[model samples]
Target chain A: MKMLFKGTEAIAEAAIRAGCRLYFGYPITPQSELTEYMSRRLPEVNGTFLQAESEVATVNMMYGASCTGRRVMTSTSSPGFSLMMEGISYMAGAQLPAVFVNVVRGGPGLGDIQPAQSDYFQATKGGGHGDYRMIVLAPHTIQEAVDLMNLAFDLADKYRMLVTILADGMLGQMMEPVEFHEMRDLRDMPQKEWALTGASDHKPRKVTSFDIDPYELEKMNLRYQATYKKVEENEVRYEEINTKDADIIVAAYGTMARIVKTTIRMAKEEGIKVGLFRPITLWPFPYKRLNELADTVKNVLTVEMSYGQMLEDVKLGVNGKANTPFYGRSAGVVPTPTEVLEAIKKIMVGDLNGR
Target chain B: MVDKAVDKVIARMPKSLSGKEFTYCPGCHHGIVHRLIAEVIDELGIAGKTLLVAPVGCSVFAYEFFDLDGTVAAHGRAPAVATGMKRALPDRIVFTYQGDGDLASIGTAEIVHAANRGENITTIFINNAVYGMTGGQMAPTTLLGQKTTTTPYGRTVKANGYPIRMSEMLSTLEGSAYIERVMVTTPQNTIKAKRAIKKAFETQIKGLGFSMVEVLSTCPTNWGMTPIEASKWLEENMTKQFPLGVYVDKTKGGN
Candidate 1:
């Protein structure tokens, strides 16, 4: 039940267990292991695994599979993910249930293959040309990655929307103990009446993003907005560590969140009264919870691998109730727990030089 | 006068067609290609289990015309999309209807890789030598010395690359089971083109590897010619550049 596995491998296995029978992806660093694992294992399970020609094809493949209401997913790094933007927008516009795993690396233009949280905006915000939102789940540990991969399919099917598992190069390549969940059979899953299977017993169905008429397009956008509002209301997830009795809260997610946890413990040992606030669901962000935490904290220190991308969200969450400062390392430079602790200490001492 | 004998139904619209009028320009060969595919699907009794992947050109609204289940794919990504559809539901017959710009230009990688993988799907390629939907623009299949919006001075080999022979190129891949280049300019050629489409569909139905039928079509509006003149022009000039006939036929023997 428990085994040492790389985060990418664990996510692949978790996908298999979650009844994801179709895997379409292009190989990118840190996430190639996931695609390679699928290529080997999917056949054994009678599932479809295709190494697509490119990230563009990979996402369109997901779109096709998702049109059949089947559980499908694709994984890529930043540059590859960028290539998939158009397809992702199509999937979102069509309201297809699919999963995307971004083993994020440094970028602006193929910056580096090392881990970075530079894609926070691309993942949470609309990366492609559309007024659409995808459910984004950021996991800090390999085990959490496995768990979230299992849940992503269900949430995607539930909302009939795309779900993104936003991890980083470090989490994807690092090995950790992960307990596998129970295997699910695709046969037991509910059928999607809207799928484009065939016109055997019913009329044919069409999966498309084009509503040429402006009124129909606007109506579709409104429905999508309503669905996203519902997701924000019900699906916000996060974790609060030592925030109950702390003066300073560190807001982070994914790999940065793991480092922030360590910093929280180190600062607590030094009696700095610093805690961690990690957003598990980055899109349906835990803004309300962060607001509640801000009410008790003196200041919020946001840590990230990029140059303060998520800092804007943290500041918005704090809503002028608490002073928010940011400390970040850009272009694939990951900060150590000591460095984060020093940043937290600086914030506590009112010397917000990094801000 | 004796009552006229009841006229027999010489031909009727195939049930696979939804009776929706095509959105293609007048004299567009897409209408003919759509009818041929529908007839094939009907003849094979696969209409109930067929899925068409419509591409992003003039035939982008193909789903509206085909009664079968369908999905509209991004520009040049129909083959990739059809690959997924066929792989996921192997029992279903999948096909992609694409234009020259969509397949030969934007989606070159997808088509080549899908054919190389021997994915069990059919592709109906319409090579009009110019982009249709976005007005007249040079396509990858545009013949040398042909003029278009992008090639106002004519498509010269020095500035623009030579036209791609997709059928011949795809036939070179070992995975492709059947590959043919046919034109719909004349009634005789239309019949030949229909046979090629049916054969490509049959190749897929038999679970053969990649199959494709590239139909050399006419773009009257873009060509700045009347419908009749465009057809004659395609028969004259296009055929010389992109020859017709079966380039590869795995069932008949070899390429």
Candidate 2:
């Protein structure tokens, strides 16, 4: 049942297979196909599909549905995702398990419908209030979009944490071949010990973020910090290409990463020993891998759709060990391979000048 | 047959829920409304099967009062939360309790759309003419020429706004399966209010569609009077603007 589909549809199909029985969301550009696909498919399987009146309502619905131990999800673009911040904070605070997909578009606010990676800071820094972090997976291709969604659900259930699939609008709109997996057996899935299912004689399970006691809230914060420590230690994932003995490395993610892969190949043809480091999980940020690459690579050139947001992390990873330069294209434009190759040449010249 | 069902439901009220004590100021209708819902949940034997989504305003702390699985929603978003709860667990009885300012002002879109979508859920809306929690601010339901904090000069169509007849507005929508406006200001009306609540829940049980019972409530604190004065006020001025009695009853018609 392999078929060519848009990245958004691939994610939706993967979610349907992951026992995601409830979906509450609003339609937004670059990701509307995902909701449209769910509306057409969910009812056939007796799954819940609700087009919420607004993004704010949709996310709150996700909150309530998630509270009931159902595999719930919602998808939207940058602007819509912003409107969902309050509910996202609630989900994070309650330590609820839910999956959220952000097909990012340009903006600080309603910038444009075109593809953009400007939401990198918002996604990585926890888009909502209070002290919390969401497990963020960055998918470069359509196949990864499908694959990551299943993994997102599992990890969300396992950690009782919010999981996010962060992809740009271009990746969402582009068509690519995606592999499908066996449908997860809902009965075989683990039962949520914390969800509000019934009010029988057993101990009542309260699903809430409110803690009037300072000590209890403090303990919750420490637990979250400890959890993030474990995620940083065990959950960091990335891809390496031509870094075996390469002199220069180009770090990117999502569409920019794919473009960097092609640019590295072009650079190699031109007798420039360039490599690529594509971070798959942007939240755990793959700092250790970047540190390892810094030991061998003389220069690291970071590229993205937004103007140098992730480059800051690359700099921290390099930690003054190498000369790291950033190149960015903004306002609905993706950087082409030629542009990245040109940036690589500039970085190489800068590297030679330092010698 | 109706009497039997009501008696069975009345028997299941949890002891944890105070059988009589209430913090709602005297003549305030919230105590009556909450009691009716708790009684109905008990009567239907759905106390354990129901998830009560509570709204902000006076009922913000309803989680403390209701013995059922309760979730607190932000202002005006209780219906959205209840919609999510209902869709996620089709077997559970999910309902939202909201006040006029919460439902009509901030949450109007959510309530209207949830009903229009015919979501399998119920809404218990309490319409008190003045905003009680925020100190007697003029609410969406504040009648013309009514005076309050912001409308000290009286709610004027020329200066302030007209009262919103929410139940009637919602009854006109095709998505409304059972829409009723009841008053809890008197015992006779209290019986009608309970019947409406029971009918709304039954509609959810049948999986018919969206059902709502808008209860005309009282706010003595905001009305510059005692609980008795507020109840009398509700019977007098508020009823003239909001009105009572069932706007639409489709329970027998089966949606």
Candidate 3:
């Protein structure tokens, strides 16, 4: 059965279906509806929803919930996500599993509440301090958002690492048709042996991020590196659209990918052979696939809502094989399909060739 | 041969304690406070169900000494972490151990709001006059006219703000079910401190509300005083600034 839902509400309901019973978050724009939805729905399912005092506290609360070996999540926008960096780092260091949703807004400082993909670097790279990586999934539609929310919890638990849903404000606020999956049984999930359930059934456990001894810390870092390597090898995902026989290919993710899809359609009508490569998993970015596509495509156009953030990755993936051009709008500006198509045309016509 | 009569235990570590030596300095009150909490947990028979949220000050590694499921929280965020733990596992007993720097300064917002929300958790706050872990820096509880590394010439009211009486301040909040300031300066005072710790946990077990025991602890190493003198200094000076008493006890009114 198909149900229409805002991107924010879909993610919230998906989390419930995914057996995430504990949620801790502070109110932030573009994502407040997610929190508000959880507040009303969580209790009906006997789940806990706590609106924390601040983003700092909310993330720490997530850390606490995560330590109990429970599925937990929080959603916020850009500025609030910045406040959660420290807690995110702590969770990473402790090797706890939790999900974070970033309904990204404009950046640098207190940017407007409109949609922007400027947090690409902060999300794909470690937003917090230290050498750590989160599994970042970018969903273009509300339906994809629902499906990814279910997968996110499993991936977080599978790797014992943080997982992030990177969505733009437009995707968060937009309404679309979504199909909710069946509820997952909490008992069917894998047991967390390291969790601090209690001391009665087993030896006392201490979940901590502190390691004073340099050698011990190094060993922990090596373990994390090994885990991330496995994730990179096993979890890279992306969607390919008409790249099999195309002269120009656009590289985008999330909302930008959706717009690029329209750009491809428009370009096709004009006899412009343009395709798209949409990265579903943004962190272990579909670099290998893009490298292959770079071999075949004549040129690549990187589209975003920021000043060429993901373009860096595109350039790396293209690896001098194809001419890579960039187009973006910053500070809460959403690029329309015509504008994106024009940029593609510019790249295809060699109008932006040398520079 | 008469079997050597097993002297009914003269002294032994509490069952809740892991039997590990604490790393605190000789005169540090953290050892005393840890013992009191362990004893309370043991007596209440909740050691098996207790979860401790350790803080990032001197007691940052407190999980090592307690034989209970615990997690070491980030600096000054123990209350927030504990709030999450208790809320998630409502059947389990959760508590936080924090210091002056961790609780009164960086964690002020967490503690205040946790209290306001009346989270069903207990807090054991150790308020030394200075930041012991960072080497004698002034703390939010530092007494005026008291000299320390940060306040070399003496903490002056003109320059620095007056010491915060957290127990008194927290008592004003409606969500706080129990708030008391106790010290372990003497044997009698240690007993009173243990009693206060017990009552704090009892409040939580009863599902009352937020209960906290603010311990007026001594830091001999930081204060540049002998272990003996630190006790006297705490009793003479610290207690005057932070009066030793129960500011709020909701159970007293049978609430």
Q: What is the lDDT of residue A169 in candidate 3?
A: 95
lDDT of 2 by residue, A158-238 (tens): 888899898988889989877888888889777887777657644445666666579998998888788888888888899
TM-score for each prediction?
Answer: 0.96, 0.92, 0.97
Q: Per-residue lDDT of A251-312 in model 1, one digit per residue for the tens? A: 99999999887887887788777778999999998889899888997789899999988998
RMSD of each: 2.8, 4.0, 2.1
Number of the top-ranking candidate, with lDDT as the measure: 3
lDDT of 1 at A240: 84
Docking class of 2: medium
| Candidate 2 true-interface contact recovery | 0.51
Error of 1 at A99 (Å): 1.0
RMSD of 3: 2.1
Off by over 4 Å in 1: A350-355, B1-7, B253-255
Q: Say what the interface RMSD of candidate 2 is.
A: 1.5
Q: Pairing residues by index, what is the TM-score of model 2? A: 0.92
Q: Considering lDDT, which of the candidate structures 1 and 3 is the better prediction for this target?
A: 3
Q: Alpha-carbon error at B199 in model 2, in Å?
A: 2.1
Q: Highest TM-score: which candidate?
A: 3
